[model samples]
Target: MEIAIILISALICMSVVAIKLSDTKLSFPFAMKKQLFTAAERQFLMLIERAVGNEFRVLCRVRLIDLLSLKTDTNKKLANSALLKAGNKHIDFVLCDKNDLTPVMAIDLVYGAGKDGHNVQRDFFVNGALDTASIPHVRIKAKNGYTLAEIRECIETKLIPLRRRQGKIPFVAANDRPEVIKRSTKPTRPLSTSRKAVA
Candidate 1:
């Protein structure tokens, strides 16, 4: 009877051990981030929405590769290097055409970048890449009390002209209606150029 009891106890211990092991093995190391944007980012996004109105769609944390493509004839090794360099990097925000979702400009939120060499270098690479592609990149200082008119000015004064030089004309009417909304109609793209600081 004691032997049988001992065997039963051993079986119960083994079962407990197995259950513990299974629970440990199935446990995940991740928890929900529970947020898509930081408080600052969310506030800025709201400002951009008000600033651009319905003319543009603001995309956040857009990867660099998503905004640019390498030349077809370039060497394989160099292409890989370039791709790897930009693959993980991202623009803070990108303004795309609302109708076609075409990327029109890049915007980075800046907060006294002179102190950070890493950020400065990163911006240099991003600026050079966007400049090469003729895409307008606007750096806006992070602060409170930004008016809608100021953001609108950035798009009108910088984003529009840069794309115009590339023959990518973007048309928008003051009536809160974009000309491209009429699918049967087509027009040239837009252009813009500027790197102004709004104090």
Candidate 2:
């Protein structure tokens, strides 16, 4: 009887341990759901805007665009439309330089929502009309559930590089001599000699 009781107690203790571990695992999703993403996301935008200048604005419009779908004209249109609408919401943080307001940079923070809100980052860019060749709008892929600082740092790294790379067209022409160099000119007679001969 004593042996049986001891075995039963051990089994109960093991079951409790297993249950606790399962509960700890289960609590993560709930914590994620409870996380206040918007506030931190907004803070990140504000930080960038403050650091850069008031000319550029960062827009967080993950809800409007479907990240799972392939890129299409319809998606593009929808994304632009959403940004326009977001502008009305005024959820952006402006970046400014001393000379002028920088062009607004749109960032979409895509999170896997509902059943699919896991391990997905959907981002797109909308070029602002006021944006110039030097300063263009950028799109960034933000990892879901990242802290505010992490998101800001990621955006900075990604966008700074993108802005640097935008207008660069790769050299595609052949290594052969250029057309201008290939044009041969006849030997020119000396100016004095020509004049003397004419005289």
Candidate 3:
């Protein structure tokens, strides 16, 4: 009995050590951080999101990509959907961002000269909604301002109209209350200066 008890305690000690070592080395889901896009790309994205009136909560980070093709095109969507259907391997980036906590902005980025039909279609969908929807749609084409300044200009323009719609003052909506009109219709204040999260 004494020998059996000693062996059991030894086994328990070994098991605890094994678990501790595995915990440190194991590649757990959600262990990796998303890669940051290039400065120019991030600048472009921030501009687009701001133009569309998303305040860009932390959830926005996951959706940021090397390019927006991940969600914008139907083929990719179908492929992803099929993956779910098949119970095949999961895509980490897509899964991480799929919770849809924030609105998804699918910007189809075409880096070079040859035109991509996928990109063209995405742009059409994004821009076409501008005329019909109150929510700002995704912008298409390389606009007059590809520069950071240009991006800022677009966001500011969108904010201007939203402010106008709100009238003089903005009011907070509360439980079972009437839509409170805001007393101040001031536009959103611009950042004092742009800061890059990653260089």
Candidate 4:
């Protein structure tokens, strides 16, 4: 009985030591810090927020994989290809339906004419993916501060046609139309000069 009790005590000590060693081995270092957005991106997001108001939700730096999915069946090759194409890419901004969070439009802020070869290739790939998925996309130049009217114009010109093609009408409810009319009739506020140009 004495020997058994000693062995039991030894076993408990060993177990405690093993647990501590495992915890020490598994410990990892991590840094928690604040992430700063670019000045241009900040300004752009502000513009998008003001332009969309309460009508739509604007999501910034959304991953392509989150927005897109493999439409094909369980073919491994096709699935892998789709993943490879979308895995590392992200859209600058995505306008989503306020009610259901369904993606309505994707906007990419292009600096200059996108003359860089890498940028051109990336643009082609992103545009192709959006087009193949039947998602409307607009490439806006990173110019001096964009006005609310200009942003609305871009949506009307680029997204409305796509929405129509998909048989989706904007604000179909009679009650919703009145709110839109009321908002449209309101005077437009001038954009601030301090707004930064998007890069």
Tell me, by lDDT, which candidate is best. Answer: 1
Question: Which ten residues in a row are the worst by lDDT in model 2?
Answer: 62-71
Estimate, for each residue in 1-199, the C-alpha lDDT of model 1 and write its tens digit.
9999999999999999999999999999998899987676788899888888888899998999999999989899999988998897788889898889988889887765443322543467788889999888888877777888887887677866755665787556488664554564668665653666679
Assess the local accuracy of residue 82 in candidate 1 as a C-alpha lDDT between 0 and 100: 87
Instruction: Give candidate 2's total backbone clashes.
Output: 8
Model 4 lDDT per residue over 30-145, tens place = 77656556567778888888887898899988888998877756599878987898898888899998999998889877777564321433467788889887778887777786
* TM, every model: 0.64, 0.28, 0.31, 0.64
Cα lDDT of model 2 by residue, 1-199, tens digit? 9999999999999999999999998885533456445664565565565555444444344322221222355577776765564343321223333355443344433344522332243222323322422333333444435455665565566466455465443444676546664545777666565343554
> How many collisions per candidate?
17, 8, 8, 0
lDDT score for residue 141 of model 2: 44
Give Cα-based local distance difference scores for all models: 0.81, 0.46, 0.45, 0.80
Point out where model 3 deviates above 4 Å: 1-39, 46-118, 121-133, 140-147, 168-199
Query: What TM-score should be assigned to candidate 1?
Result: 0.64
**Weakest lDDT window of 10 consecutive positions for candidate 3:** 88-97
Candidate 2 lDDT score at position 145:
50
Q: On a 0 to 100 scale, what is the lDDT of residue 33 in model 4?
A: 52
